[model samples]
Target chain A: MDERSLPDANLPPFEGGRSLLLGGAAAGAAGLLLTLIGGFIAPKAALYSYLIAFDYWLGLSLGALALVMAHNVAGARWNVVIRRLGETIAAAVPLFIVLFVPLLLGARYVWIWIDPPQELAKETLRLLQYKKPYLNFNFFLARAVIYFVVWSALALLLRAWSVRQDESGEALLTRRQRKLSAPGLVLLILTATFASFDWLMSLQPAWFSTIFGLYVFTGGFVGSLALLCLIVTGLRSGDSALGKIISADHQHNLGKLLLAFVCFWAYMAFSQYMLIWAGNLPDEVTWIVARSRGVWRPVGILILLGHFLVPFFLLLSRDLKRSRQGLAAVAAWMLVIHYIDLYWIVMPASSLDGLGLHWTHLTAFIGVGGASVAAAVFLLRGVRPLPVRDPYLEDSLRYVQP
Target chain B: MKRYVLGEFGEPEDCVEALRKLHEAGVQGLDAYSPYPLHGSDEALELPRSKVPLVALTGGVFGALGGYVMQAWMNGVDFAINVGNRPPHGFWTNIPITFESGVLLSVLSIFFSAIFYFFALPRPYHPVFESEQFRTASLDAFWVSIETEEEEPVADLEEKLRSTGARRVHTVVESA
Candidate 1:
């Protein structure tokens, strides 16, 4: 078929539905109200739950940023149809910075080593003292600000160049994006790693995993891919322009990527466990011991089954990957599992009873997740869903699996 | 003896077009050989989806169960031994090796099934090789073959093949 005959090439810009944005905003506001009520009722639980939600959503946004940059750096053509959606997702980085304010205010309730309680044992206090330079509040805030600035600038620059390409159709902009993506990716990895370390890992100042940063990154990457799949698949319904341009072959490719990252996440999770088990050091072993015994044990097993084995087996079939409903089902399952995975990571540290689930977990998740989706949808308004003028758009539209 | 009509093309697109035309003309027993897999050519030929993946899945399940059972029988029934005071049938600890064996057997099944079942390998001779043009099917050409009863008109089929874009067409006969 000739490329020009395809009606997708002349697709108009997406004018996002007002109801979708308004619905998202309403849900977000309701969640925020619940979070506030939960905070007043139980400040400590609310703070910890908020942190979990914060880290989960942040992982998704940054993960999308990294993927977008990766697509640019590799000059990949298969993703051009959905590339603008990724940019829109990445544009939520600034909104996350604003959300972080509550976490900053509530830090004292979550971080044990922040003020070093007067009742702390001699050994723990000594351990915390040794970690003082890195764990101080001032340094933590500064690092966070730096991470946001770097991520926001990169996302905005790439998005600006993409929008410019729509009007000018300058092939040079492609070269410029390709050039910027290389360093942009390096900066992303560095900032994301330290940010994960400072934000989540430091919750247990005594325990550490050398691979923790990569482990967190893999979860985020997998979650982001799942989110992208869901968003694209959702838009592909309802007679949208995206529905015509995107094909089963694109879904198959995305499904393959989602499978690869699921395996990658499993590998990272296993490697961390095996290393910690082999070393048997008290600090590292404590993290695993807490989760592997009692109520937390079932949660650990759930992660193993739901997060890895089920998705791995389901995605293995070529037919399933190519089926829109099947792929969407898997993507939705992955998104839920990703939230649980983050819950497994964050909640165990603070829960006195192993595998505790407070009502605030749900409220905070909705509050933060709803607000993030609203911001992303708002960014999508008045923009072309597909990178309409990208030199590779035709290639992406015509892509067929060999 | 059975007579077969074969058409050869320099490119996959021409071969696919030829296959589509022949199928529309009510041709039966159509098959294609190409230097590389061609998109939609399988549909053009109306071939069923291959069973190689099913074979692989069965093999993987068997291998996984075999691996787990071997460990369980060894530790719990056959010759029980205690290692680090873990349970006799600790499946959690047994997962890595079980997974390894499953993947190994699945891959091996795909490899061999694709060769033996799909490709029908190990035969030293076939009538397709009687035509020299068929040799290029593995190099840079596409070939389509149709089997028909001895009474079918050969010239008409050849003309259809030529009109549909085959570079060349031939008829071959061999004893059943």
Candidate 2:
């Protein structure tokens, strides 16, 4: 249980991180350049693809922030080993603020109300007029700035305090973090909820689901957990001391959590659909109608199977949950399905009739994802992979599944 | 009549280690008792993995299928009530109940199977209970009990238990 017992190599600025940062940056540069070029060719599709990619990466960062805050607020010890990973991901929020510029510039293209087309239905035009107070471009930009500012402050403060604790080993720092996280979680969830309303829900301005925010949040959180699984398993494959401390028991717990959240995301998705289905109202049913048409129908079914059913059953086995390879594979699959889930959400608004598959989708994903990875690794540089000075670090390391 | 040799250890680890050693020694009919579940006790005792999950899965799948069929028959075929011009057997409406039934059956199977089959509850008596000091198995003590027939050698088993760090070793006979 002693900190001295662990190998000194657990301290960061390692060889793997350097290569990871460089690789991520190079991929980011290439992807962004490609996305830019693709934008000029098919401006509308490119904008939508860029939005999907942007939302996917931003959700991950915000979800990581939420997880770290939840861990601190709840005094969870099992995840203390992976706390820094969450912090590193959360630290990418500032980078996302810069990434938001492209989406902001093309907001009109992605959102219908920003500049409603002349052929928009009379009913929809009236609805947009009524929603004008909340859906205007300037207000939308302002809200985006506020969201990033709040997220940046929360993520940076938590990371700074945690890193300071590594050097000073201040127990007060832990209590201070718990206190900050208590209010921080509430604020974060509220802003995130409203942000989902602004970015995703507004895509279908005529339609609204009260649970859309929760649905988005749940999907993102599940994705973040999947990312954690991959990173933990990936690190174990290497010689990182951080990976050495994590036992299969920890992975099993994480797998259990991933399953739980997967179900939660499904539940939220179903709840939204069921309510709208039962009401059979024009405002609500139109959203579902748009999605169920053409190739989108198959995409919806794919989401159901890939996102929930597959992961649920796979993670149920004790053997799979305990094995690094099994859990990591499911995690990776979940990440792919998560992108599809986002694409399904954002792309439907772009092209209601078809899949609207674009080359920019892949490029924008690489652009955002690679840059996010680079930023996370950069923040992680020179920092201990785990909170070595944490009082509960030993408890986490020695945790046995009961 | 069958005789049982029971070893009581002060520590769970020692008890589990003794179980492992006894298993390695090729001793049969082994079980461990403690106030709380001990980690690695399953492996130490070399017990096969529990089949409750299998039972639960079977129960859940059947339950879900039955739930969907019940709804389909009642709404779509049997009663055939028309509501709101939607499909008579609404897939969306059927889902919640299907899920609930699956969970319900899974829980029922797990609970019943565990009590009636796995734990073999309601018998009320075990040979290990013949030793008055063995009562601590459910309190503060960790116990490993080995069941044997009347013809097997008991003295060597008692000796083995004492050598394996058992604080209070006792032999008990079933009264028929």
lDDT of each: 0.85, 0.88
Which residue window of length 10 is worst by lDDT in model 2 chain A? A1-10
Instruction: Please provide, for model 1 over A295-364, each residue's C-alpha lDDT reduced to its tens digit, 9 standing for 90 to 100.
Output: 8788899999999999999999999888878888999999999988888888778855656677888888
Look at candidate 1 and tell me the lDDT of residue B52.
Answer: 78
Candidate that scores best on DockQ:
2
DockQ per candidate, 2 decimals: 0.29, 0.42
lDDT of 2 by residue, B1-176 (tens): 89889999988888888999999999888888899998888988778888988999999999899999999899999998768788898899899999999999989999999999988997798777779999998899999998899655788889899999899889889888
Give the Cα error of residue A54 in candidate 1, in Å. Answer: 1.1
Instruction: Tell me the tens digit of each residue's lDDT in model 2 across A1-402.
Output: 112244342465443578889999999989998999998898889888888888888888888899999989999998888899999999999998888888888777788899999798888898899999999999998998899999999999999999998889999999999999999999999999999999999998988888999999889999999998898888777767777777788888888889999999999999999988987997789888988878889999999999999789998899998888888999999999999998888887886346888889899999988999999999888788778788788778767898
Give the best candidate by lDDT. 2
Model 1 TM-score, 2 decimals: 0.91
